[model samples]
Target: MGTLEDLTDALARDVIAAMDEIGDDRFFEKVSKLLLDMSPTTQEAYMTAIRVRLAERRARKYVEDALHAARAAKAKAPE
Candidate 1:
């Protein structure tokens, strides 16, 4: 990625970390609004990064839950 892309991704990571630290789920939306007044391109990139990261986290959770359920079922099943 180029400088802007790198910077945008870094900022996105910081935003996510801050949201988790502060216990405010809508923090990114507030950041997005601020970015709107600054640079539309950067704002879009930041939003995209946020969306992708959130999606990945959700997907990972789904996979982990499924695995746990499968292991539990196996343990309960008769040999």
Candidate 2:
């Protein structure tokens, strides 16, 4: 079994790979342009929504790291 750090790093790499497959920078640029073109109120709402979504994604990654740590600890524990 992999160490917790190793598993976490692998998962992060996988996430980056998936994002790359989806054209991450292009998506960000598009969203940024859309946000810039919106009215102030609309831009505020859109930015808030984007921030929430990003926070959720970060939270999910944190959970994944925690799970990996738990699994590694369990494996290393003596019977």
Off by over 4 Å in 1: none
Cα-based lDDT at residue 73, candidate 2: 100
User: For residues 45-68, what per-residue lDDT tens digits would candidate 1 score against the true structure?
Assistant: 989889988889889999999999
Q: How do the predictions measure up, each by TM-score?
A: 0.92, 0.57
**How much lDDT does candidate 1 score?**
0.92
lDDT of 2 by residue, 1-79 (tens): 3354454344444544565798683354355466568555444544455555557879999999999999999999999
TM for candidate 1 is: 0.92
Flag clash pairs in model 1.
none
Q: Which residue pairs show backbone clashes in model 2?
A: none
